[model samples]
Target: MHGSTPIRASRTLKKSHANFYRAFHDYFVTHLPSSSLHPDSRSSSGPHHQLPRSASKPHTPGEGPSPAPLLGGTRDTTVVRIPLRSAKHHFGVSVSRGTRPYNEDTYQAGVIEVPAFAKPRPLNLTRAPANSPLEAYRAKQREEQEKDSGDGEGTSAESASGDPQVFYFGVFDGHGGSECSDYLRETLHETIEETARKYDLVSTLKGKPQTAAIVSSSSSKEAAKDTAGSATEPAKGSMPEPSISKASTLQNNLLNSWKTTVGGYFRRFKPTAFASPPETPTTSTVLTHAFLQEDLSFLLAQLRLSTHDTDPVRSDAPLNANDSLYSPTHFPSSDPQVKKSFKGGSTASIALLSTPTPTPFWHPSTPSTLYTAHCGDTRILLSRVSDGAAVPLTTNHHPSTPSESERLRRWAASFVTDSFGEERMSGLANTRAFGDMSSKRMGVSAEPEIRRIDLNPSEYAFMVLVSDGVTGSVGDQEIVDLVKESKTPEIGAREVVGFANEVSVEGDNATALVVRLGGWERRSEGGGGGMGTREAREWRKREAVDPRGRMT
Candidate 1:
């Protein structure tokens, strides 16, 4: 604070305020109608899209010519969601997390990737006509694919069973270490499953359960270990799973019930599931695929050990316990028994598409769930086709949020300084993350602000979820217009990524993943969460096509 001259300091403060304005620019957006669609996004290779808003209505599922849903699959307790567009598809992502190296006041470096998700959708992907720019463009796909085909490849069917066709895919950007990222990638589904199996019973608690309570008061003392605010809580793995209340688990139960309900739909109405003559769609339609990205980088501690720390948070665990992401050559451990430490962590935002089952009728040709997490600012900036205009779908968990600040206040009562207390950084080094345990002691949390959106006609068109890397300088509503004004989702992603990079200062790892889903039948009574009349008719049309969401 002392090194700045008066004029320089004034300018610095001005830029900081301006940056914050860029970070949160909603009031500036002009209200627009939903009918207008930007033409540039579709103008093959037209400079990356950059607009503030567009009034585009959600695409009606079956009524118009549209792409299929970008993702599909089963919904149950075992599902974990991330939003990471694949490499080949027209997907892009942007990431800018962490305090600046010299200026901890702002984000330094960031990463941005295009066409965030290369998901399989209902559209046809037969080499875009002939002589198109894409056909003319060249990349070393052959060599890359061959190289990536080996073991330990970033993508393998290690956990995939039956088909690797993802129903949903997401990105995990880690800051402190890859341990947390790896943990989520490997066990998110299991965690979801466990949460579902154990948590569903609570939802059914409105009535007496068919079985006696396994987690009773007799086990309350035992339950102390797994409780939310346990002072002497064990590490994640060591913590016994006696069970507790949380949203993730709630989602698990809801999914399980739906599965049971659907299974019954076929069993009770065997004619539909086991018809004799079988059924065929009246028309022919094609399918395509999409993909998203994830952030699995060197950890801070690992960086520290190797000139950077090898590992930071020391915990006795099974996998990758000591597989330090960064190298810590010096510095003390933030937590004892570990290598060096870091001041902060990273967050990963991914949006993936996949097929959960073989049933047809869904739009994605697959099902997709949006996965947005924050560690070091690689985020998925998505605006829902709400009432045709863009409505923010993801919540940025920052220090300024009231509830978040409250949680920290309670967590950091004894540790507060005169200024910069836990309360001061609610959205600042706040709760929920992909990394940053250092912030966690001040109660840096890891509760992701996740949502499962079954693309529907009502919530039509696709969305663009950029990171602070993109949105930081750009206002949220401004981003809405950029995509809305664009002609295609692909172009929109590229355009935004470019603009974000230009505005970004030094030390920013800016990455962007843009996902434009084709045809989404918002969950109606049958496949969607609830049935809207428009959504219902859309489903009926798909039933005319696939039946389950697709044709058997």
Candidate 2:
């Protein structure tokens, strides 16, 4: 009788959920345009009754149709919401608890808009007199300016007035516990922005010339060379003594010209030190490493402060009435009593999609470039219609990797593989991660591998960021094919998580983030699978040997 009662309750809950879904769907369908509705809802003879040829047929796994052309040949394509069964495009996300008591996987996706007014303006330097000692210097200055401008064309007023949007997505997988992953989800982006701002300021300062000093030195050297070279061969009508005076005069003129130029450049550029710069530029991998290190240090300091008292009650005291003693901020990194509480660590994988500045003229509609930074085993995969396959954007970082295993051995850390056949470093599978203070002394690093890829809007389809929970159970190609078969990104994400849960025996938390790279378009026809397979393989091989290349 008790079992029957629970079964009846489950049926009732399912029915209620179904009713709610149906009501929401009906409300949503009513808001869409009449033409976007199902054919039965629109008259057969209506002007917009016919569906696009690509949408008419159902897409099979790994058989995505060619993408439809971008409306008006630009990224400003219209997004039409349709019924779930007919939906063809939408960004989606899925987070599943799987069989874990607590889910430690987290993902985020959103657009960041940067206004044109926020962009840096070029400096205007004073022109030097023709044939003056400073003429070569002026030529060099012009060359530098041109190179900085890229393509010698400044941003147009129209482009400057418009706001460019960038999409960012990331996946974080926590081990031991979810504290570190949750903390990163809240603060990593801001930290990256701060680091980028510092880098930009340093770059700007380094680029600026000590105009007067440089010009004076160069002018003096050139004048002395001329004086020495001309001494042996005096011109037919020129006075030899006057030539020396002329060289001195030329040096003086160059110095004066440089002073004026420097004044003008500074006045026009107004290069003031910014307290903060906008977060658009790709962040250096070192910044990621430094940020994690600093944050961990700060946490450790705070924890030390909170637990300095030797008294059991005082040392374990909570920060507030509602807060727990084991909260990330209060839990001491070194305290053995709370090791289980504070030992949690997490892996971070971030993908930043940013619009290039001085937007390329040839491809004015160029898609945003993708920059990725990862530590641990979470993966990023790019699906390209041109390739018709999934391409791995990041390699997993675990003890299984030769580099990681060698590093662990060098550190002399003791660990044993579990029943799952996974190698561990001081009981941690990931060789690099954030907040593994217990293993930090054992050589687990916070450094991340970074990579950059220019996305072509025409051929790019979508990108997936997933935790190992998904990759452990599903193949890269299978994930790509599943996404291709789904009508929209959201559905694709849900399907991926669902598949991972079904296949994974370990019951780890599963999370997937699917980001559409371009506007809704039908998949192209007759494209070969895996366009950059060879290049990707070569890149992985090279990176394994030297993971620190170009990181900073």
Candidate 3:
């Protein structure tokens, strides 16, 4: 009777195990589609038979049940029956047209491959002519390119180590129409790269005082000779000078002498006279401002030219379309009728991350850097995993801000209060943007506020670039939390977009780009202990009270 009792207990245990397996199988089948299951398992007749091949084999009494069958089989044994998704389509973008008739928001995020030859290098002006600043500038640029090419790190290094990748992300918000935003989405990065390269060359030339002095002296000498010749030759019906004015010549010689003296003193005292100084944001900021302003001006000019050609009435009409033909002061129309051509303008917010390569000149302590240029309401936020904080890296340029409001008032721009009590710059919510030629006269600028942040791999976690649509609906803490919780940047971006669409305000478009930084692995390494630190708690408390305070 005792032997029979042991047998009955064993049978009961087996039954319980089978029941548990059946319940798990049923839940898996109900929740996960057949496509998510292995093909062999899908064909099995019952829950027991649906077990993986490894589980089908018998297990010894002392050994644990052969590792429980996974929801999906191992990669080698099982094929992923699900269709593959492209990284560009999946990881790159997740956007939603919210309540707006059309999505006026445009965004771009991608890895840009930079060739070894394209890397920035110091220009050598050693062989540049002592005179002719423009010639010296050209020579310096040529020498820099030649030096870069001579480094012998082009194709071989690129093939072995792969091209250095620069991750670029941007969001453009269009107010009146999508044309300007669309245009910017396609060309802004290229414009920035071009502007930066030009600025680098110009800044390098400006840094060399000796070369500049030489050029300036040459220019002064040439001016003096021209003045003397003009005075001697005399203009038609003009009186000739009694003696060739030596004053201008004498001043040029004295200026040259002073410059030479100063140059020699600096060269003798400063050991690193030729070394390039540490980079600053001033040059980049100025370049960004100039590029944006010039691009907008070019767009306006093109519109005007096109309008002048297309409109026969304007072409044949007098200079001032509003003035009568008999008006005495009538002049040819210099400005184009671009207000009608461009109905809307866009706000541009761009972020660029440059990762250093393993070159001979590369410094081990020098970290990757992030550059941001913004002109509108879109935002860039940095999350440092060490502190568990969301740091706003941009300020929204709107008339609601005191500084912007003051600038608009100085420009004599008409302002109206909206339903939300926000001041509008000539009926536009944003004070700075590209296009909107009509509002430009009222001081609507396209000059971007550029910033640079050095990325420390130990502290940096991720960056978020988003349009106002997302910001309007989501708080900074919430965004950081969502991204922190996500397993991957692609998933994080999708989740953020989904959340924004779910709770976004009416008549807005939502877009988000999540960039995972260098120290993402540190989060997993810390096992959540990092987030529990005192500094992290403090950061969270501060964020809760005022998320937008530091940002504004």
lDDT of each: 0.34, 0.51, 0.51
In the range 56-163, model 2's lDDT, one tens digit per residue, is: 333222211111222113333332323332333445788998888989997665432222111122355776788887887666655654554343322211221222
Lowest lDDT block of 10, candidate 1: 283-292
Question: Which segments of model 2 are wrong by more than 4 Å?
Answer: 1-90, 111-163, 201-282, 289-302, 305-341, 357-365, 524-552
lDDT of 1: 0.34
Candidate 2 clashes between residue pairs 3 or more apart in a chain or in different chains: 65-523, 66-522, 66-523, 66-524, 67-521, 67-522, 67-523, 68-521, 68-522, 92-490
Q: Write model 3 residue lDDT over 1-552, tens digit each, in one string.
A: 775665566566656644432211100001123333443754456344233443222323222111112222233322111111122212335688887788888887653322221223333545646688867766565465445434321211222123234456778888787867877776565555443333332221112111111010012344222211211122233222222133233223333532343232212221111112212212243334344434445455556555667777766875555432333233323232332355578888877555333221112332455667777789988777566777887788888776567756756446889898887866788887887666665666665665555565456667788888888867876676666667766787887787766654453788888766665544334325234343543464565457485467
Flag regions of model 3 displaced more than 4 Å.
1-91, 111-163, 200-286, 305-340, 358-366, 523-552
Displacement of residue 358 (Cα, Å) in model 2 is: 11
lDDT of 1 by residue, 1-552 (tens): 454454465566556644432211111111122212342455575434343223223433322112221122222211111122322133444444433442111111111111112222342356654567655432233234335433211221122111123322345444434354444444333233232233221211111111111111112243222121211222233214323344333333333432343232212211111112211100000000000011112233434444433334433333434432222222223322234444444454444333222222124443443322233344444444333434454555555555455545555553333354533442344345544433434555433333334443334445565545565655554454445545555556565655555444433433444555543222111222212233443443445445455535
Candidate ranking under lDDT, highest first, comes to: 2, 3, 1
Candidate 2: Cα lDDT at 318? 58
Least accurate 10 contiguous residues by lDDT in model 3 = 209-218
TM-score, per-candidate, Cα-based? 0.39, 0.54, 0.52
Model 2 has an lDDT value of: 0.51
